[model samples]
Target: MTATALTMLNCHLTIPALYFRGINDMYVRHSRIQHGVGQGSFHSATVEFSATGRHRFDYVFDCGALKYAKLSPEFQYALKRVSLTKRAPGGNKAVLDLMVLSHFDADHMNGAQSLVKRYAVDRIVLPYLGVEELALIIASQADAIDKDTLKELHGLANGVGKLWKRPVTMVKTGPRKTEERVFSDDPQREPPDAERSEPPRTQEFPHPVSVVLESTGAAPGTVMLDEDNLVVGSSSAGRHDTWKLRFWNRGLHATLGEPGIWQDFERHYKRELPQTQTVVVPHHGAAPNAGARFYNPGLNHRPRVNAVISYAVRNSHGHPHPSVLADIAYAGGRLLRVTDDTRLGYQEIYLFRP
Candidate 1:
């Protein structure tokens, strides 16, 4: 694609269909997850599903850094970079389709308010927590944050709309049957997957495309089926050729008392974990907060799972804990961290259609 053609596509024009046959194609060509570099924790990625080379879903999993100053420039750059291949239609501003606040930790969510104010975010997802749990997370950061910043955080804790005018989805932990729905419009029925005009041929994308994108803390109801694709092997009525991306969040407080939490998250997504090929290690790779089970090699289909860690060098907490490193090594997983190179300040993983 020429630079002009790419620019026109990024602007959401319909000119691509004239030159490319994959304009309406349903299968996911590949997905590239870019981990942003900052002193603290920040993660966001642009998923490209169109064979014609366009990003369909732009999402930010978490945003915040140990140093507040770095958050603005780094996050802005990330936001702009992801928006290059796509922008929400009928809008002058770049659109961020999804924003998931993993937890209320300052390092994980401090940049959200600014982001919401600057960009056009279609939906926001966060773990459902009681007033007490919200208080606990806020209090943990009170000593370090300013009163105004604290107030803004508190506003977000109270209700997402209180701070920003975007819709919010709360994911909670409970029996799989009682999970709350987020991505789907119908609460009772499963969200529709990407549109499939016909069954996928065996020759498409090869066999057993690994990498089950599973989000802990999210219940089965939170599973979002994109309108342009279907699960690779899900028995749903459609061609089983596209990759499945499900979001499940496990609501764990930032404090270190929840060892059994991972188990609950694991059980909630037990049906989908086996196909997992990449794991976005939580809590900046803190063992106590996320545990070693995140790197379970026996269950993950791939020989070497992609273990992505987002943390900064010389951080106060010494993130990407030694234990987490050991867990990845033991599982024979590949460790990719944003801090691996200071100059780039970003790490990426590309998964192509077989």
Candidate 2:
């Protein structure tokens, strides 16, 4: 938590977990992983951020702190709700650390728009080039953005003007090796609520206690399990302060061939550490994010990755291609989908300060 400790971490180390509200949803499943990883260190303070009043496609990402920020309908609703919760004292939810736009598609941008309009974001992160550059999102004749959207873009553009000084990258790195310890917990539903005088409002982050720490500190695959520790609610895993990944859609050959693309994320990661824990899968787990040739894990030393997509089940453009899923398995990473728990609203989490 000091400047010295901060120097040892990866950039991705601090994103508490995030989830989404699935309407016409595809399997983005990001929340599921966060739900799993979060365990019990931080309360997954999440809400249905999307409102019927907003535009259809946009989804936003906010930490109630300013590491990085973006706008979208889903995000806008989340912030409106988060603002009401009175965020934890100093979680950096307000600091503009990084920014990302999956694609230039209006729905995606709508969420970006909302973030730009609301927060003092420092950077903007996006795939190598958004669909707008491909002449698909802004100029697509079949699904061109409408007047209302254009107006939102105008506001977003104006907002972005102030962020010229902030760093933007396709890959983000954050604090270093996080230490983990287990805590007490219960299985199934209903955790014994910690005795807080008031209902948790805003992100009840920086949890005070309740760990189930125990390590044989021995050989591999041989460790004891604490019955009191709820794996779902335990804060035992350690995280590197810093992390790294390449953000591109599909084929590694194409990605590797495109040196400029890697330059962005690489430069960004090197700005701090050598690697990252999570890399936003470039194309929402699509073929473009993978390659025909096998990916060499030894050579790659890939980070803990999970695909983050905001598509619904019946979306015209199918998501989470079979190949992408295989790639994650090959890479030993997890596939997180937003649609996995539409019934749960938005899945939320908090990254601990190691």
- Alpha carbon lDDT of each predicted model: 0.45, 0.29
- lDDT by residue for model 1 over 1-354, one digit each (tens)? 100001000000000000001213333433344445555455555445444223255556666665543454554555444542224341565667667666656666667777776667766656664567657766676665557655644565565343266666555443455434323322133323432223333332222121222221122232222111112222222222233433344444322224454454445344445545555555566544443333333322345766667666666766767866876788787777765244244444443432
In terms of TM-score, the best-performing candidate is 1
| Collision count for each candidate, in order | 16, 90
Ten residues in sequence with the least summed lDDT for candidate 1: 4-13
Best by lDDT: 1
Candidate 2 wrong stretches, greater than 4 Å? 1-103, 111-137, 141-144, 148-260, 271-274, 288-300, 303-310, 340-354
TM-scores for candidates 1 onward, in order? 0.63, 0.39
Return the lDDT, model 1, position 149: 57
Residue 322 displacement (Å), model 1: 2.4
